[model samples]
Target: MNPSLRNALTRLAFMLVAAAAALPAAANIDIQHWVAPNGARVYFVESRVLPILDVQVDFDAGAARDPAGKSGVASMTQSLLDTGAGGLDEDTLAERFTDLGAQLGGVADNDRAGLSLRTLSSARERDGSLALLRTLLTQPEFPAAVLDREKARAISGLREADTKPDAIGSKRFARALYGDHPYGRTPTIESVTAISRDDLVAHYRTHYVASRAVVSIVGDVTREQAEAIAVQLTGDLPQGEPLAPIPAVTLPQASTENIAHPANQSHIFVGQPALQRGDLDFFPLQVGNYILGGGGFVSRLTKEVREKRGYAYSVYSYFNPQRQLGAFQIGLQTERSQAAAALKVVDETLAAFMAKGPTEDELRAAKRNLVDGFSLRLDSNRKLLDSLAVIGFYGLPLDWLKKFPERAEAVTAAQVKDAFQRRLSADNIVRVIVAGD
Candidate 1:
């Protein structure tokens, strides 16, 4: 086959895999898990539905792991992984993937950083992509010129964000809730400017080790092939010492900060640290939140704050469960003049929900909505790979996805109320309003 035509065909195959419909919920997702010889935790699900595979390797290296006074190191390190690795420059590395019909991406969040790949499962394409991925994981060049360029770009982006009212409100709200915890630390221009190449190399060496790696794989691969893939990917990783657990999140004293911004709308955030990832309270809190504010226009927050009073166009609440205690946040934007009234309604609604919990009808609806829609979460190989990564990284039960509906249905109104009351305290809640009257 002509080289160009062959490459185009391979790319089309990958696109077809991505566009394919979600595997049926009834399709057995038998997950196989093991630890590689070099200590990488691996979880895999095999599906013959497509001739493509998705792989994600997660590490305990995220923004929260940034060294003091260097808040953007982890993120910068992750981004620089593919820029130059194994003697390949940025453009060559990217073009190599293009020729193989594979996609490589990286993610950095509060608690984890990692690379993800999607490639055609044919032996040539799969082998070539995995080889590149292995090089990225083990031998990133962290080229000096690239580091200088990215640092400047990051600083520019941070400066731009500083001027936005929503961004100001978010940063203040994080600090108010998390106090001095790393979770509260946002990357400022100064912090990114201070991140030298040595900082990136050191952060990568400390955190990107075999022991901290979680390799999740999904799609058209056999168990034996998957095992070999895991070994090939992580076998060369540095055998660094175990990472120290992140510090616990200290709940903050209840306070409200009103920051002046020359914007027409007020951005508001409410609530406090409430749930950790994989907590027993996840279902109860999630179901209850749907009634409180997560159910879109049908939620009580929307009814009172947006529909009835027209104080805001949209309002919502959610419990973001991270490795440590994450925030239970209520967010909305409204006309500056109505910020106070909107906030008042949000607070009252939240207090009432915490006091009485979701109504029976609301609970049933929430469960139904979650349960009926659960299949959507698993419909794609990429989605399955994501869930597998969470399960592997967080040490959640292997059957977590399979049991979601059962657990969600089991949550009672009393459980929801008790969970909320125990987790959220009015005294420790933080509220930040930007551009409010």
Candidate 2:
């Protein structure tokens, strides 16, 4: 086949798949899971509807896993995977993916870090992409020149972020909420400067091992093919022991900080550490949060602060469930003069919602919205791949997508209220304001 013609076909197929993905899909997500011989957990979803395949391999190597005093190591390590792998430099690596019409990506967060790939499922493209991924997994070079260049770039970026009000408020809010926990630590110039090429190699060798890997594959592939891909990707990795679990989050005492900034608007963040992944309360919390603030204009927070009082352009709240206890944050920006008044309304709204919970009608509407829109979540192979990665990495049930709506519908008003009351308190939430009066 002519190379140009093959590339065009790949593009057309990807476009067709994307168009099909825009429609609602069946809620029944059948995930076939197994553990590879090398101890890598694998999750597979076979979808022959599209010619594209998506794969994500996650490991317990996110920010929380960064060595003490090396806050940026995990992110840097993941970023540099394709910079130099299997004797190929970064530019050559990029050319290979381009020529194959495949996409290579990376993921980094507080709890997990790894890579993802999208490619045509034909044997040539599929096999080629997987080979490159395998090389990244088992043979990243961590070249010294690339490390120093990236370090300088990261430090420059961090310095620029320090001057922004929203960034300052966010870092301050995290510090206030998580205190000395690793979750609170964001990369600073000092920390990034402290990291060395040796740190990246050590972090990868310690955390990016076969035993800790969760490989999630979705798209046009058979079970046998998927099994082979999983093994081929992880088989060469060292079967090192999983690292110790990240420390559990503890609630910090409530405190209010008003940082002086020259910005015209005040950036405000308020909340506390709340739920973790797989918590039963997620259903109630998810349902209730929509009524409280997650819903757009209809939410209580938006109605109170943005609609009635017009104190801010927008206000929203959410519960971020993570591998460890995550944040329940309400965030907004308003005129500096009205910041305190807006915050007062926010506090009152949160307190009332905790005390009374969502009304019966609110509960019904929330459930209706959530359940009705659930199909869209699984409509795409990429989305399915994300769901698979989460399920495999977190050890969630295979039927999680299938049963999501049922569980959401089962949440009652009383349950939402109870969950909120138990999980949040007015006294313990941290409040941080930048440029407030």
Candidate 3:
């Protein structure tokens, strides 16, 4: 399905690795929560460290929520939210933000869609930014012409991706793992082609409602101002109930899928359903994965597949914990001729690690790396704002950021082995290979 934690770890890995290689500070994140008048949940962090403000409005609408026959509706709705809203065209909205020195942007991922604003905390700039954001939220007009243009552009991009072996591998890997589930939904020429403006309007009406929203605020603002900002952002949206929960992920039975491609290198994906966000195994899996394949050049997989044997230049794995069970995935790009041998080594390496877990020294290094890098994740208010949005959307523990370090440190090697053995098995691992000789 969606490799949420994979994306998360890759981004965090960059920030975490570049931080000072010392012990992480004891984090003290004061997160506050409330409900706005319009039923939007609000998560606020009063930060006065800088004279700036960051606000994000998130809804439970994302790619996974797309209607059965319309895979791109949610993404299109989010992309068009600011194109023409409250009587302002896209260009006019851009100008308004520029004049206020505010950055207006958004993202639509597998589990959530959100818009964010960053601006100076001065009343003139902050108020203007919030006002503009409110307009985008409460009055998105999915202009038919704009929708048509974007659809054409998206089709072009999708078609281009269809030709690339790497793209095909990733998309098919999801299908191999989560067959018939919403998590595996990908934009096809047909699926995107079928999406009408009416589809966007309906998705916006149903999933962009106040009750499904999470208003996350960070940086220079009082609690009172934060509350008012949250209300202004969400108070006038359509009222709708929370969405029904997505179904649990069912792991694909073990099988190998080899597709012919002209590329000289094979793009391979090996994984299975493993863990969910906030699972008790989160720490063990997080720690153990670093020792297994997540620690960049120092990882076991990289050393075995790249450094030791020169079979590939890059190889890694991670646990992608989503709302339901996510995936533990190992990926590599190797020459077409070495595809079979590389895969054999990968299979043996995984089995050995699963059987024996990481050594004591490996476990210690994993904890140190994870703990030292934890602070980097919280180094900026923008990062913290993003974290708050994820927490609110997933209904995770409010103290998740605070507990990340200690929990990771507490994980024993046995715990890691137990967790991995219970969740992953050779019996269920799905393999996807593109471009084999």
Candidate 4:
């Protein structure tokens, strides 16, 4: 090889290495926020890596706000929103979505109803997908035929779910925890069957209002284009009064109930309703829960219930805070013969943790794992978009993500013990064990 040629190659390689070293670290996520002229909240983040667009429209219409005797109305209403809209029938709407190569979806949980769309970023695809979203949000047809079919499906699902021991335990657990609250009532087959097209239409018109919706958009689009899309999608939505406020969730009085079931394994749901979105105790509780159960194989529950005694394959606990007070549930399934022993161990562990709290080593490991694992939560545009939506919907601070690590690291052992003692009382916890000896 000539000396000149060899020297040139070495220079090129050195330059490439220098350039790579100069590149910035990848922890930054650029989020943009604005309010639409029509009063809808909009959040956007542009990413050109993927030639796709993801949009979600969320409303305050959740099951907790359902009226008496209409336990499933919120979910049913959300389902029918996109089934038939504007002048399109269900079949036509589905065909159009498929033809455009777009996916339309809906999700209904205890605290919100959401409709989402994912489409290619091409102009034709974006416009077509947005048009369908507009119809679903504004001009849902709620045709009589589609309503009947959906009702039948819901009822059939309920009937099938009733036969399973896990299902029975969950249904009874919710009822026992929530009592007469809307959150406690699972939709009955009869109640679902009674829901009609008019009922859904009325529910949509009342709750799916523009002022109540939060629009989240992420992907291959500019801020200007995202604003136009948001308006075009939600402009025609009814401008109605804000939804009626959800009443505070009252934590039920403490009690233990063991229901008889024929299943060979017992299902247990134990805990109480605790915490909400902006609660001050959230960070401490979250960190403590990691030590208690949410941290997979490293969690105390797993160590006690599975590794030590082999009583169950898995055991977990989590604090699900929502618009109102949410449940802090610990659950496991074990052979009926071993259920009592398993429950005893679980209670002992929980009681000991509450009284003494996690040790220094446990707290350090929990913080390390949570902080180190935070990057994976925001690695994709879709995940970032979802986080932005939750922040917007729950009115969390714009810097919530940035502050998460600091909060986790700041949690003291005394604070965890104090928070747990204040938030959870073993004597006041609700214990439901199904098919236990």
Candidate 5:
């Protein structure tokens, strides 16, 4: 063979290998399910690859359920749920978990509150950890001392966050977009101080019903063991009234507010309340967003704001669909001097996309990338458990994950254009730029 031809063939072989390496491993997820006899929703995935059990219990008691004046109640309530429960005090609970070689964690977000346990699948470790969880869920003592300390900590954190420009922008943006809705409120120091032990108990009783809970278990656990675990965890909770349906989010009219913040860079966010979890437009909107801004370097916003003009270090956008309509936001940070220029480019890019949706090539690439990357989203038991929790919480179809790629592939250019046309209007977007001219 000629030397040049041989070198070219070697390069082609290397390229093919690289391309194959880049593709994600095929997804072979097998999700199983059964309702606990106590009425708790149970989602399980049995993976014997590792002798670890990752269990998570999610409740609908999130920040959105905070009372009008007590914007932080849900947050504080969740934080204290495991702090003191059953006959055990906070210190004893911590010591017991440590002795069992188990890890316990809790998360409180806008849409949900969750308690998670990670332990060895051995009987002693698993049973000990699960017993603690059962107490935390059904027998929280809500000790007065723990409540006072956590309240003080929460208040102090809120005070510190108040001084941050990004925090101010986020709170104001949520307020502006959600208006009088519960989603708009941010917890204040005053509200945190007002939260009493009784408040936590009441919130838990009302929202932590078995029917409203989803128990997700993944790892080396049998079907019988999973059912037994779910029953033990949720068996004693009072079967309260069904969760009050979350009302629709009415996106308030667009309005610009200039919050005075003494910061060197301006944080600008433009968007409105958008879709919910099960909305028909989710797939199209999600795929279109990757083309518009969610694709990092390949996104239109990054190309316009950073690559082309160098107005900001980073510019990005995403759609967050929660139980209620969450926001579809474009965010960027730039020096006060370049804020106006950056904002203009973001607006122009969004306007153009709204008028003429993603091109066929752009749509195809977005779908291809998203579909190919889907498996990675469920590669681990923790990831699978998280996805299952979301599915069970939102009443999404059991086949949502299996069907995700197909749906992305089926999203036509016309559907992407139509979904955006009906769901978002450029004229109705709220633009908030702090420290900008």
Candidate 6:
């Protein structure tokens, strides 16, 4: 969630709304699919239970697509989409949505850029808000002044992040793990401030084209309406070429980067680029990650580092599968003096798990938690929209949701051990320690 939205939602968390429950078998919910005349792929799920609608438009334009010397173009383009569009300025756009009781936002990340709208299903509200959404999509102004303002804001944020040890360690970890891979590049103050309106226009024209779009709708609408919505969103898009696939990520050789900082606690990170989204090894790694470090109190790393030695308050690890090989990162912050001990314990815990695999009890518990909690993933329109966007964007199996729990259940201890052993070599791990002696 965006920080602004998070704060807004935090306040709304106390408000009581009519409670609704998803189907008992949320995983088995149907997803309708089609392609628009303009070459945009569309996915939809009709949930007439609520008189509401959620529509999202996604393109294969993310940070990884940023051109050399223009590291923040993708993000800036997404942000500026809502700044002004059609004939409306940011304030006018805000007023339009507010009048209609609609929520609007844009999301940009490593593999996708998206704009989303949530509105009441009545024709008066839905039709108008969606029309405004189309204008934002097809006619973003990228006003010169807004571009300058956003660039300055981004640079200011980056400058603050630069001073934080955790942020320093994370950025260094990416560079070390990816070397020259596109996944490694992030906006620096120099790069972000260097961006201009021309750069935003060029990137938007190239990357936000029709051929590269996925229009996802989850709401109380009919098939005819969904098709119309999809076309309205992408038909006017520039027919620029779809992005060429990102280059494959190569594993980094074992290395360590230790940076000195004036912080009381050291921030440490470990691991390397591990798996992409549709890999066969995903199941084993997902289940195995739980027992190894993703399960909180039950995880081996937490048990060894916090429960036994009290080196850190919390420790965790997980795989971030992306368009290319994302990372399998383990991260923790500890008192600078105890950083060494915490890191040693983390390594030992990982090594032991890789050698022996998770215990049967741990495997059962992990599977149970993942399976039992699967329904929550589809419990809301927003959550369903997320899944649809990912599926449409990544070209995953249409029945991926149905197969998710089955795959997790099928993963045994031996399979997990083998997957981890083959996919990760402790020898090739890259380590980053900030402010630790």
Q: Pick by lDDT: which candidate is best?
A: 2
> Using Cα atoms with residue i matched to residue i, what is each candidate's TM-score against the true structure?
0.97, 0.97, 0.93, 0.92, 0.91, 0.95
Regions of candidate 3 where Cα sits further than 4 Å from its true position: 1-26
User: What is the C-alpha lDDT profile of model 1 across 1-437, one tens digit per residue?
Assistant: 45974866866677667766647472367888999888889999988877788999999999999999989999999999999999999999999898887889877999999999999898998999999999999999999999999999998888899999988889989899987799999888889989999999999999999988999999889999999999899899887897788999888999999999989999999989999998999999999999899999889999999889999889999999999999999999999998998999999999998898888999999999988988888877888888889999999998888888899989999999999999998998889999998
Please give, for residues 110-215, the per-residue lDDT of candidate 6 as tens digits.
8899799998788988999999999999999999988888888888899999999988888899999998788899889988978988888988888888988899
Residues 55-138, candidate 5, lDDT per residue (tens digit)?
999888899888778878888888887778888888999988877767788768888897989887888878999999899988
Q: List candidate 5 stretches off by more than 4 Å.
A: 1-27
Superposed by TM-score, candidate 2 places the C-alpha of residue 84 at a distance from the truth, in angstroms, of 0.4
Where does the lowest 10-residue lDDT sum fall in candidate 6?
10-19
The lDDT of each candidate is 0.90, 0.91, 0.88, 0.84, 0.84, 0.87
Off by over 4 Å in 4: 1-27
The residue pairs found clashing in candidate 6 are none
Instruction: Please say which candidate is ahead in TM-score: 2 or 4.
Output: 2
lDDT of candidate 3 over 328-385, digit per residue (tens): 8999999999999999999999999999999999999999999998888877777888
Candidate 2 wrongly placed segments (more than 4 Å) = 1-26
lDDT at residue 271 of model 3 (Cα atoms): 96
Q: RMSD for all candidates, in order, please.
A: 1.9, 1.7, 6.6, 7.7, 9.2, 3.7
Candidate 2 residue pairs in clash (backbone atoms < 3 Å): none
Tens-digit per-residue lDDT, 1-437, candidate 4:
45753564466457445544332113455667888988889988787766678899998887875667877889988888877778888888888887777788876888889798887788887899889888888887877877778888888889998888789889888988888877788888877867776777777888788887899998889998999998998888877785667778887888989988888999999999888898889989999999999998999999999999999999999999888888899999999999989999999999999999999999999999988888677765556777878887888877777788888889998998998999898656998988888
